[model samples]
Target: MSKSVPHAPTSFRELEAPQRKAFFAAWLGYLLDGFDFILITLVLTEIANDFGLSKTRAATLVSAAFVSRWLGGLVLGAIGDRFGRKPAMILSIFAFSIGSALCGFAWGYWSLFAFRAIVGLGMAGEYGSSTTYVMESWPVHMRNRATGFLLSAFPIGTVIAALAYGVIVPNLGWRCLFYIGLVPIALTLYLRRSLPEAEEWQADVGNRRNVSTSSMLFASSRRLPNAVLAIGLATALVLIFSQHTAGYGWLLAAAAIAGFIVFAVQVAGRLVPVMLAVMATVFCAFLYSWPIQSLLPTYLKSELGYSAVQVSTALTWAGLGYAVGSCVAGIAGDALGTRRAYVVGLFLSLLFVFPAFALPAGNVVLLWALLFAMQFTSQGISGLLPKYIADHFPTRLRAAGLGFTYNVGALGGAMAPLAGTTIAGRVGNLGTALMILAGTLTVVVAAIIGFDLPARIGRAFKADDEKASSAMTERNTTRAM
Candidate 1:
């Protein structure tokens, strides 16, 4: 995506020392994003009880946050392009950390809802900044592995949330999880003090035509607006109420939304087909994927009669799997070709994972085992995107492009809980509700069939690698002289 990116060192071990610091900052920020989201998921049951919310209403709070994410991605992403990734990342992290802390003080459903929306805005910004910064800084050949490693850190947050809920909630209560959000502010300060912009990003800023994101999206034919509205409507409905019956209403909603999206995507193809494909892929994948973290804690407790520690342990194992899967996915994507790794590898893994949800009571070993495998496989798909998106979009608009695509897809899939929980509510089987969404994986696989993104970027990567390597060599020679 970066036209003037410096050449990669032959191996990741040779990555510029400064880039490693940028990567660490992005990784920590993403890890906190994971911690914040899953922290809320783990405590949803308590939040509902505290606020006298129906399952749907509680999920609505999560839903509103998802909807706001697109806007956050757009706004902050543009800022990353205009100001610098470092500044954008710093501001975004602070906003979310403060928002997470404020969530602890929420007195009612509306108050929490509002705070989460603010957090959502920050979350979107973090996603945009982190994905853009890390992918842009790395060598193209190893982008998948780097992005996967970064993406994997997110689940670690979920794992931490599970542990915190298990340990802190019993002793300190649910508010403590929100309070924990403030701790990442330390990361914000660290980033401010140490983080640097990628050389490619620096190169692009000098001569890029800067346009507002609003102008681009509003004028980008049906590509942006159509994707946003069609997906938004369906997800909002599912989140607000599944009383029309969980699976039934969602099926219709998905169908109607799909129809609108299909029509919108029929436009003449663009250079960034990978971006288009990923946006579609994530929208479908996340429908089932996210709910595993967002709703499973409550589901395991309510239906399976698990104690707090059991839920925590099960999810922790799953989170470990998620971490492994994300890392493996990147390497696998590079090995098997990103297409097969995601479509086939991730899809087949999801199939095996479905049975875990239906586990009978007291089979703790099997529960944790299945959950571990499922998360490992299910999570692998997410690891591929940062590299994929970076490869497709131009450097100048990279953050906004990645941000919009990621959040728009997230917006579509945002109703996973509303839809999944509603089915669980109706049929009284959380596992089965999850099984119903397994078909979404097919949509993800199908979208990737036409992409040969690596081929498209090969020349650019080769050129940039040589150029960057040359520049670095020159700098060293100058110092020696």
Candidate 2:
């Protein structure tokens, strides 16, 4: 007879030493994945200079990476569901690490693009497996908080990338940046040695060993909902992209529409209105923040005549803002409730984005301050969305649902840089682009407050909080006895 594996941990503190270690290991690996993905963004101008390519072509390289990530999410999510999360994580880490190393050696745009695609493929598996592993291991009450903690790494990864580029790229060149990117391969090896198979995944593997992969995610009854979620996510992402690309004005409008649509749907379903409201808030804040994020480094380089290292330093500070925001959001989600925290953070984001856009480009200090405020709010609120999605699904289909939804959003995000660059290139100005993005975010804010703001958050958070509190109380009482 199969022996019973230990039950899932009921609280963050109750997680055994081994389990906590594994979680941190997985978290770091995911963080590195984010770093590898965004590294190219920081060094885009350098790449263009070296390769003699246009900005659009350089942007395509970034887009290709996201496309690869989308494909990886689709394919690897299924694999994670069938094979097991641990193995998938190991393979993904290895794939991305090797792919990043190859990027350093690329002789042409096409070669670098191919390597980026490979990295995306590797990254595809990283989130689904890791998120699933963390979600499944934690107690029900702690699920949202735990997921929030894990996701907080995303901004941290970006900060690391910014720092690396800031310190290394000016002196060593952009190719060396990719060479440094290979350090995460050692991380992959460490994960392989340290992380045990997720107990939940092992059980899932044993029970469903005979089931076909497609049937697992796309069963006849579940197909409709899955398709709906995917479509919704894709639509939201597209709107997000349009905003990021066109201008703050466009982004604000898109965010408003998205928030309104999300609110309307949740209201119709009698779900939490706050959930949609918070999402809208985040979309708006992020729209205001994100354009400035990637654009600032380029702006400093081109308009202000700053060196690559100076640009990278500015980028690092922005990334640090994101990291701090994410960490704060994670902690706040557990304490203030996910919806409240998201709303507050998003409001702050909106507040920052508007004034920052109003400042002249020559005012670098003011611009950085605005960007930091935007990122802190946007990234902080973003940390909660994945956890919210994960909390909504059951274990069997968790990875697929999360992967599909996220990638759809990513697709939208991927489009933003292209749109932004094209518009700016055509207009011969970045001001218009910033305006459009900010506008989109404003719309997103309106959508949040008017639409479903109470029901969905209530449903998702209440169940999770209740379970977590009960578990912790019982554990404490047991110790007392």
Quote the lDDT for 297 in model 2. 65
lDDT of 2: 0.64
Instruction: Name the weakest run of 10 consecutive residues (lDDT summed) in model 2.
Output: 263-272
Error of 1 at 247 (Å): 19
How many backbone clashes does every candidate have? 4, 41
lDDT of all predictions, in order shown?
0.71, 0.64
Question: Which stretches of candidate 1 lie above 4 Å from their native place?
Answer: 1-11, 206-278, 439-481
Judged by lDDT, which candidate is best? 1
In candidate 2, what are the lDDT values of residues 1-481, reduced to their tens digit?
A: 9966655545667887766876798789888888887787888888998999877667667665655564466557767767767777887888888898899999998789779878877887787778878766555446556677777677678778888887788688888888876788788777777777766555544457534244644567766765675455444443443233355556554653454444234222222243343333433444454556556566567666766656666666666777777767877877777667766776666677666556654676776676677777766667776675554334444565455445534544455566667778787766567656755764564355335343345555553443243345435433432
Could you tell me every candidate's TM-score relative to the true structure?
0.80, 0.74
lDDT of 1 by residue, 1-481 (tens): 7666455465556878876777888998999988886667788888889888887778766775675676677678878877777788888888788888999999998678768877888898998888778766776556688788889888898888888899999898899879999998988878887777866567656335434343344456745765576466545543433334445765665755554344323320233344455566557657757766577887888888898999999889989998998888888877777666776656567566657866788899988888888878776566886665555456666777778667767865567887887787787787788766655644554444435433344343342442244346434533332
